[model samples]
Target chain A: MELSLFDVVGPVMIGPSSSHTAGAARLARVARQIAGDFVRVSFGLHGSFAKTGWGHGTDRALVAGALGLTERDERLRDSFEMAKAAGLEYDFYTADLDVPHENAVKMTFFSADGGRLDVVGASLGGGRIVITRIGEYPAEVTADAPTLVIVQKDRKGMVSQVSQILAAHDINIGVMRLSRTARGEVACCVIETDGELPDGVLGEVRSVPGVLSARSVSV
Target chain B: MYSCFADVERLCAERGIEPVQLFVENEMRLTGRTEREVYDRMDARLTIMEDAANRALSGPLGSVGGLIDGLAQAQWRYAQGARTLCGAFLNRVMARALSCSEVNASMGRICAAPTAGSCGILPAVLLTMQEQYALPRRSVLDALLTASGFGAVVMKNATVAGAEGGCQAECGVAGAMAAAAAVQLRGGSLAQMLSAFSLVLVNCMGLVCDPVAGLVQVPCAQRNASQAVGALLAADMALSGQLFPIPADQVVEAMARVGRQLPIELKETAQGGIAATRRGREIAREILHRERA
Candidate 1:
């Protein structure tokens, strides 16, 4: 993905966290893409990022941005102050994940309608970003691209069956990442493929047995 | 159809230009922006980064708790020197690279290519070579053009985003570009430039994008220092006639493969590596707690 100065460079941001402090918040907001309105968010920060997260304003940034704010949004700094005003109910926690990154954040957001999303994000520096998890999928999706994220049941021949279908249409999947959900019954595949998603692929994927829902993201 | 260094060299010789210069000219054509424009954007951004660093460092602190202070202070000093030498009006890329180092910083705001994370590597290597060799500005410009060409090739075939690939994509690619540019500066033919480009990529492929706490401090700052040094080394080797077992194109393809295989946590998610460690986690908590307090 191509990053502009506004994309990688910061200052129109809240303090403390760019990846977790600010980006964690942005990831929550983007999580709304799958979860929809009326959401409950649980934020988990890994060890070091967690310790300094508050001072970095990550909690506020995540909450505020979750309530709907952009990195360039002026209100990002005051997101915490505005959370009460916005009536956002949220919880923050710390965890020791056996991951190598020093600034990782995971947010699991549930919509009122039973729709939910799990987003793992990292701030890669210069305000650059990467979304590493969605639901239970282990893939890297850019919040800056047009992406297709599919959540489905894990079954034999699933990938091949889907790959054959995509290849038939001459669509090249740039980067395909799959992670089994917590339940292990389902798997989420995040595809950062080149070109636009064909209009009806979501419906087609949804029709597949064990396929829960397929969503397309353009940010 | 054309795959080897010889093919690229032959093309460059036929075109009456060095191999690296061909890359630069091609980059200019593809971006649809002039060399001056790219330079200007990079220059401008450097100024902004320097000013921000200064603002961040205004007050004296307790003991240096984390990495931000050291990197920001270094960037501040580097920026001041860059502004003095390159003038405030240089290109953003040039300015940013110079500002990150003392001798070459520019005088203004500019655009940062690939990213602002390792902005200093490219210009620091290229400009220093220019001064050291006493080459004309045009020669240096050709080298930059060549580097841009290689950079665009990577952008097309693989990835440059630290988020997608890793710091390898950022500093690594910068080093590759600089190596090719340096080859041109040394008057190496196109084949030599390609050798340099390939050599750099082979060594840097698969390097991770693990920025600590996502601050652009820790690894990003220190990484820039190493990246600049690496680019110079790669260029020097290429100039001296080192050969790579792998092709440049193949190395780029390997980088893409590595980026794909990279765990999401390693590819800039900050979920893994140093970003997720006990110390990294503590620093994050401390920052958050301080904010809340």
Candidate 2:
């Protein structure tokens, strides 16, 4: 809880609402990372995000975020037209996530190659967001700092191997969570770091044995 | 986890400096940023706040909901030639507060000083204080740093989210934050800053978050303007040796408790207060339908 002054005073952003707009955009950005390239995406709104999201521009903000725009980007208001021009199709619907968080959304991203990614996140107000679930891998990623998400075979020592590589780069791991659907099947390791893993760290993590994909995203 | 007002006081005492120094050190230590980096970022935010206010004052009528369109500029017109009520300085405060609030409603870029709903309060107070006192930008940024410390404390001990703690948490905290910032800019002591903080909370406690139709228009804009004035007045009280009977920390605790006790209808649910009125319901429906179309 070492809150920065920026947390209390800033995040210079465009908004009708921070939770509904800026937080929505951050959630979408994280989801897009897990989602890969997509042609169509359906946003499953939950709780308050569905009820009053329209007025807050949650839909447009999410689209703009998925298109890879930062929260402060001036293009956020014109996101709908930009999405259409980019040939990206999207829809919004109320979804029953059965989660208690008042502001949540689940996204289903469908790539042209038939690959699909499902991500669930909650907008925790004041432009803060957390990616709660990514394709059945329960994890927490706030994107407050450099975050590395590694999908790999849930073999023993995978965590240590990833940690060793990061340690090699002198990047301190702030918080890490490992979630697997089954024993030795598949796992997602969400490593939140203090300093960013220097360039080429993602490629190194991807090349590690048993690792499927690795991606780094930051706010 | 330097979370509360006590932490700030401790840091200031340990370092033998003021809240401004504490702000810079805390931010640097918290984010691993350099001193220059920290000031540059704060300076950028101040620029945005000023820019938002300027745009709203000079741009065309731009509120998305048309509720607060041209409000800041309109006040400027009203301030001219005998329509002046509270003198030019106070009028400027209200106008500037509306300017930033209207900027927010129109989807213009602005710094969320704690949150967007209460964004106008600090800028209005600090900018107006600068205009009156002839303070430079550096002094204003210092005040902003001081205000951020106050905000960080309230955020830690209580809540700043309207949905969680009502408008008392949002506007109330903003006023308190602005009061302390105003005191800092005017060179008030730490004790005086604390007194001003308590004054704001004691005065504006238990305010409901009943934004009409759940939009940050209507009372939200009005509250920003009023809260700015309230903060400045509180600063004056602290400067004049007026003190709050209760301490600032206790006032924050009471504010949080009162917010929790408020009915859900009054807490941005849009099901009560002004949001529950017939016109409020109609406005909600109209906004929803218009967006759908």
Candidate 3:
């Protein structure tokens, strides 16, 4: 998509650093949307995020976002106390992860029901983020538009079925990517739509044969 | 997209329209939003800038890294007193710039005009102009639109991230944006506005980004204030009939080239310039010690 005038002019964020704080919060919020109601989160920061993240309030920003706070929320400064109150345990580590970007983080979230999700993302300056990996599937999810992240078995006609369901709802696909571990193995389909998916579309997607899980994320 | 100032100038001259109108119409076409929606969104950003510029004037504000605190209030106090040599207008401009930067460092809500590190320059100029000239709200908003157009052109031609292009890309572009807005607010011609924009860039070329301790405090806040003053002076120069030899688009290209040539240590890495000084390293170590404690 082309850059807008507003993108040059404003994001209306809480900040000491836009890439470190606002972008960090946004990345965490996207992670929260993907993995709902996690009980604990561990952040493995790399490069600049590891060296200066604390001074730039990256830790607070990440915790605030994982607690479901927006970037502009004033409570971002008090995120640690709020996380304690919310019973959302979090830990930060300076990991030596090999990432191309200077501002990257690998997050592992644990849910109360023994479910776990791994997400790796980078803050690509100016309050923009890209979720690079979800679990074992390498992905590129910007959350710029309403997106559907579907995890299913790598089988024939899976893409056709999902596209047919979305086409039935009048949702135009802006961009779509499919990734799998191997042939006929677990796979991930990331589809960004031009508009929000109508209610019950996700349910229809989940009910599809061989579809393990389907989640909608909009920012 | 409106990528170059030369094209913008040509289109404006041919159509006999202002930059603000062109930008608003382009926004309407791109976002598929009504004119009212675009203006309302910009107006909301103006409100946030106003809050940040004024929030730190009355009291001291603390930064996240503990490197600097209450400097905005100090500047405000000095401006209010009779001791400043630059008179009330410039003093208040610097104070407002420092105020907004201080608020950003303290994790207060702010509108990042181009980026967070340089958020203070544009708002300081616009708000101070409005207060001093008693300009109408509509005119100030129009000036803001003009600045956004100038910024969009810069973003298309060059970089705005400090890490990519040094402080020149962040603070220098911000000053240029403010200078263009100032010219528009003062009813200058399109040529004059572009001259002011180019002059600001020329004045701030090659300024490095070296925040002490990798926090957006210290030199960054002070640079905002200095660049706010620089923008006003550049606008005044354009209004007074001074001409810059280079065009605005060429200046932006030159800035891009210079930013690429700057060393990595000088580009927001906190490893060179003032950040690498003995005192700078000492301050970084102190902050690290405190964080560990």
Cα error, residue B179 of model 3, in Å, equals 0.4
Please give, as one word, the docking class of candidate 2. medium
Highest TM-score: give the candidate number: 3
Candidate 3 lDDT, B1-293, residue by residue in tens: 35699889988999999999999999999899999999999999999999998888887678867555777778888888898999888888998898889899999899998999999999999999999999998999999989998898888879998988999899999999999999999999999999999999999899999999888997999999999999999999999998888988899999999999999999999999999999999999998988889
**lDDT values, one for every candidate:** 0.60, 0.86, 0.91
The candidates, ranked best first by lDDT, are 3, 2, 1
Query: Once superposed on the true structure, which residue ranges of model 2 sit more than 4 Å away at CA?
Result: B1-16
Inter-residue clash pairs, candidate 2? none
> Candidate 3 on A1-219: residue-level lDDT in tens?
155789888889998888999999999998888876689999999888998898889999999999889999989999999999988899999887666788999999999999999999999988899999998889999999999999999989999999999999999999999998855489999999999989999999999999999989887
DockQ leader:
3
Docking outcome class, model 1: incorrect
State every prediction's TM-score relative to the real structure. 0.50, 0.94, 0.97
lDDT of 2 by residue, B42-161 (tens): 999998888776677764546556778888888756655476868888888888999999888877788998899999999989887887899999999888988888888888889998
Better of 1 and 2 by lDDT: 2
lDDT winner? 3
DockQ versus reference, model 3: 0.69
- The alpha-carbon deviation from the true structure for residue B201 of candidate 3, after best TM-score superposition, in angstroms, is 0.9
